[model samples]
Target: MPTALLDLILPPRCAGCGVPGALVCPRCAAELHGRPACRMPVPTPPGLPECWSAADYTGAARRAIIAYKERGRTALAHPLAG
Candidate 1:
């Protein structure tokens, strides 16, 4: 099975931190923190709807955005879009 092959060849590792034995190791994920959702909207110049963001464009969110946008990490687009 593919699962068996994966287990044999490449042990699970955290996507973010490369810790062994888990796709996303809890300890490393915990270190990547997110702030409270302030729910504020800053209007744009071209009359676009005010943008609502959960956290500021820094840290994990920023990296994720860059990865999804510039680096073509389309896998994250759907979940992040919402």
Candidate 2:
């Protein structure tokens, strides 16, 4: 379906908080940014390249990730990337 038509049928909401009119609201977007930190697992699996994340995986950030990966909120990719 065309994106415009789909949006009209089901308006986008903030993936993090369900706020109407945007894939992610300003407040939720803000929650997605933070100083980078290493996210290596405690067990340190073999060949697991060092991973890092900007925002801690909690609160709004966790919700947004769940929405994107498990709830079909693909529209959140851009905002989450930022």
Candidate 3:
């Protein structure tokens, strides 16, 4: 599985805090910034009815998205998805 491969290639580390164990360790992932309610577009072509993102793409959201897309940190996708 990709997780096994990741374990072999990259040492376990918190996606947000960079600690160690897994991408987006529970503690740091829980700490990642989030908001109440706000409409945002889905990250796909055929956008559906207005979707609401859990976190505003300002500080942590911006960083997590950039890291996942530009930096190829696919492991962070789940957490980013909120």
Candidate 4:
């Protein structure tokens, strides 16, 4: 409903590169999760016992997180989670 109207009014663009016509372009999606998952940090956060990040919170990854968490674009989660 609202998502459809918003797309019609203002076409969506890739959160990473601003490429129009897609929530996230295929090119940028491939760049995600490049490193192997692991518990690498020396002193883990207070109560976080262990954690594994898909990718560093920087560049396209950061923009993707902001778009999903702040801007309400849940579409990015599917690819981001992979």
User: With candidate 3 superimposed using the best TM-score fit, by how many Å does residue 61's alpha carbon deviate from the native?
Assistant: 4.0
lDDT of 2 by residue, 3-79 (tens): 44677799787777888988888898888998899988778989999899999888889999998788666777888
* True-vs-predicted CA distance for residue 13, candidate 1, Å: 7.8
Per-residue lDDT for 4-75 in model 1, tens only? 356568775444455678544555344344554544444535756555565566554565566557755455
What does the lDDT read for residue 55 in candidate 1? 57
TM agreement with the true structure for every prediction: 0.43, 0.76, 0.55, 0.72
Candidate 4 CA-lDDT value: 0.77
Ranking by lDDT: 2, 4, 3, 1
Best by lDDT: 2
Instruction: Estimate every model's Cα lDDT from 0 to 1.
Output: 0.53, 0.84, 0.66, 0.77
Backbone clashes per model, in order? 0, 0, 2, 0
lDDT of 1: 0.53
Error of 3 at 7 (Å): 5.0
Per-candidate Cα RMSD to the true structure, in Å, reads: 6.2, 2.6, 5.4, 2.9
- Per TM-score, the best of the predicted structures is 2
Candidate 4 ranges beyond 4 A from true positions: 1-4, 39-44
Give the Å shift of residue 73 in candidate 4.
0.6
Native-to-model Cα distance after best TM-score fit, residue 24 in candidate 1, in Å? 6.6
TM-score of 3: 0.55
Candidate 4 lDDT tens digits, 1-82? 6654677789889988899988878887866767856655656667765567767666887888898888878877787889
Error of 4 at 27 (Å): 2.4
Q: What lDDT, from 0 to 1, does candidate 2 have?
A: 0.84
